[model samples]
Target: MLLTAPDETQVIAREPWIPRRAAVCLLICFCLTWFYTLGARTLVPSDEGRYAEIAREMAATGDFLTPHLNGIKYFGKPPLQAWATALVFSVFGLGEWQARLWTGLCGLAGIAMVYLAGSRLYGKGTGVTAALVLGSSFFWAGAAHVASYDMGLSAMLTCALCAMLIAQRPAASPRARRNWMLGYWAAMALAVLTKGLAGVVLPGMVLVLYTLVSRDWRTWRRLHIAPGLALFLAIAAPWFVLVSLANPEFPAFFFIREHVGRFTSDVHSREAPWHYFLPLLIVGITPWFGVLAQSLRHGVRVRAAGFDPGRFLVVWAVAIFVFFSLSNAKLPAYILPMFPALALLVARYLDSASPRATIVAAAPVALLGAAALVVLWFAPAWIDNAPASTPVRRGQVYWITGAAVLLALGGAAAAWLARRARTWALTVLAAAGFLAGQALMLGHESLGRDKAGVAYLAAIRSEITPQTPIYAVGQYEYALPFYLGRTLTMVHRAEDAMLLDLERRPHLWIARLDTFVATWEAQRARGIKAIAFVRPDIHADLQRRGVPMRVIGQDARRVIVTNDVTAQRP
Candidate 1:
């Protein structure tokens, strides 16, 4: 075996065995990789949480077509994700977990889709390697855990491109050609549903670029226009037509504002430089990142071999990469669709690629270990001051620091394994990284970021009778209402719908931002119980106004502040 743990990537031009052992290993790794995202359960309404809320709202309101955000008709994103979440909610009943179930499933589907594309088009060995690289990829992994639209978008994009690449060929039969074109149409439709026009455009452009660079327009013969269009419309048209009809302005905003304006501006607030994805790609797809680099370097050397599998994949990867790289606004996820292309190229290169290059590349694995130890060593100083008030135990940071050390060891071990032609060791390194990172998230960081707010909301539920009107001062955590089984009104800087609700009811709870309240010092004085989800000083500052709110529960970024009603002479 010419495989090593650090570079277990297989040959891209042939088929490999579907080894049972490898299958089991991949299952376990992916299973553990996304092991616990609190089952997409209640915590806080992140961007993802908010989207889920919109879907639930739609289902409840019987407004199946139009997408709503914060109970308002929002036409920013397409209705695919919301619709998907709504379907799950309708079937399983709405909850945090149910709302995110479909997206989470999509994440898993993407991993499997990429693996199939790599294995079938390239080789089985390459397929497994690609799957490992993708699963361990930071952005991909993070997307899987969160309820954001990116995961679903990535899944669709990968499928669309992979479906097209695998099916596109010069001497394809009629059936194969029909299938490919149909795939193009179906994938394009799903992509549109997932994230609107760019889904189709990005993949379509990449395919066009690959074919043009390869000088192989003959593959266009496979496009069965009638059937393809039919399939596309069947999957995607109903929602678009209904939603557009429901809200007449959807087309203009969705296409023009979301696709065109987003590309040209930083309205989504994910703006980055022209080269943002360049470094982001490298760092986000770590360990195997060296694999993508080596693959590209090898690709440049063999560029003259026109129409070769390697060239086609490289062109596909580089074209997509450069396309997003040149864009004014970029996000780490903008490069996701490029991963499969890179993986395919790497798989091909690994078939006859140099051993020394891979081994030498594995050297960086050591740096990860050093980084972990450094962070762990000064964790007390570096770890966010967890408002938990429990003295920072060394045990708490142990998991992340330990995992860091383990990945570093993997780098060294992978180097040795590569020397011995043990490519599968690469799988081990990825598994270690995945386990470490995921464990740390669930075990520690998630406590503060994912659950603290939910916990704060949960604690005061008893105090919040049915009559209690809840107000979210800054933003609503979609998961909060779902978890608490109640909805909360949102209040901005000014007195709005939320304040009116408070005036109308007795048991009123407000998710007040400390600074916003401090600015409106009058409100801070009236607030009997302050649930501070911020710095200690903010709460301490409030004491100066004669409002004594005690912290009942604490996490890294959130604190539940409640005042003693008995002490107050009302």
Candidate 2:
């Protein structure tokens, strides 16, 4: 019996028996791959530490509804992720792993959703393959372990889409369909809470397009829109109402600015060309890029009579992909919401695509290893111009070299196994590739440690006293507040939603650079202690102005300074 990628006929013909233990084993492997060295790296700035600090503030103030940063109103995002992190922090006592555990859990749940959806729509083989494809994808795995709202939003969207697809099936019983509809509503509501309006808008667009393209308007009747809408409102509305009532500025900042403005304008200065996510998707999928391309190509074909799941999945994936592409704001992780559908579609294709195609697909991944080898050998030359403390570690090079070798070996093994055992080949290749990629990410943590401010914070921890007012002048480091166990008073740098907070509470924020300098001088004259975080350029400028600043600590990112009187006293 010649083993080849299944065709449409072969897809229906093949009954690859996937044992119950396969799911259990997959879950175990997922935990290992996703959570490995999760806490080994310090919390990265401006996102991970920002979210963690918000959660810490929530826990400290005992306020779950209104999210605050630096003791001021922060209405940039809703409080779902902050709430979850606060809960984790409460029980786990506020650590890196605790902060990111929610995201990691969401990532795992997303992989599970794809598995179940694939199993129900195609077969167990397709289901398992889809799970592996998504669970091991470079972007998915990497995003999962970070402390961000994207993972939570992606997970909820996956649940809503997968549950909706399952509910629309002709084989679904009345009760089963109703339950699935309810689940879909709940998922969308949670998604709304996770990331403002994109949660509902993107899914709504996909559903509308799918209805028109597949000519399946009758599917709407089964959606139970009245109850579904009620459920969605029930879960998603109270937070908006409460937050708005509590902070009168919430409505304008959240809906108009965060949702509409963020999508249409380059409000955050995150502008990119339409093709930004193209290379991201290719690199994101990594070893599975070959199979994914074939699967997506096959996804357009019409199949099944009542509700075409293939077309629907394709629509779901493509709609979101194009939605972000058309948006003015572009980030690599913005396309994360589309990955689940892509995984299912890829699983469908791998069920019947050619064995030769699978082998050919593994070629790029093998080459990726060779590239890593080059990077490993040239690490020193590459980072020569970096900061004095930014030297590449031998361990990082070793890890990269090992990952490259592992990916190459996995690709080689898959190529050989594709001739006789395609399923085994894919599974082995996925596990090896995912583990190798994870190792590389873990290894790279050291490169950013200096800039992340863990060491600098430790160096200055004892110098800070309860009465000493610490100011973050000109810049903010997200990790600093969390590590210091308090917030920094902002001076001359209030951007994003922080700008709105500054408006609400002027006293908490210093708007003028000159005002901060005068205050520092006055405090030093009175024999009061004061400290500030300034950028290197700002430090140089202050020196030129003869401000008599004493640099207690410095790094590539920021310089920690004190008034000369404070330095002399302590």
Across 1-570, the per-residue lDDT of candidate 1 in tens digits comes to: 222222222233433333689768778757754645636334344565567777778777777776654455566678788888888888888665676676677777777877877666556776777777677666567667666777777788777766665565333456775676677788779888888887778867866876777686765555666788889889988888887776566677678767787778776676777777767777666666666767876655554322344556677678778887777677766777676666666655665555564565466766777777886777776445655533334445766677777778877776777656546456666666666556554545444444436645556764556655444544444455555555554443222322323444424443355534553344445653333333445545555766545555555444445543433322
> Which residue pairs in model 2 clash with each other?
5-352, 5-353, 6-352
Q: Find the candidate with the highest TM-score and give its number.
A: 2
- lDDT score at residue 347, model 2, on the 0-100 scale: 78
Lowest summed lDDT across 10 adjacent residues in model 2 is found at: 1-10
Cα lDDT of all candidates, in order?
Answer: 0.62, 0.82
TM per candidate comes to 0.79, 0.93
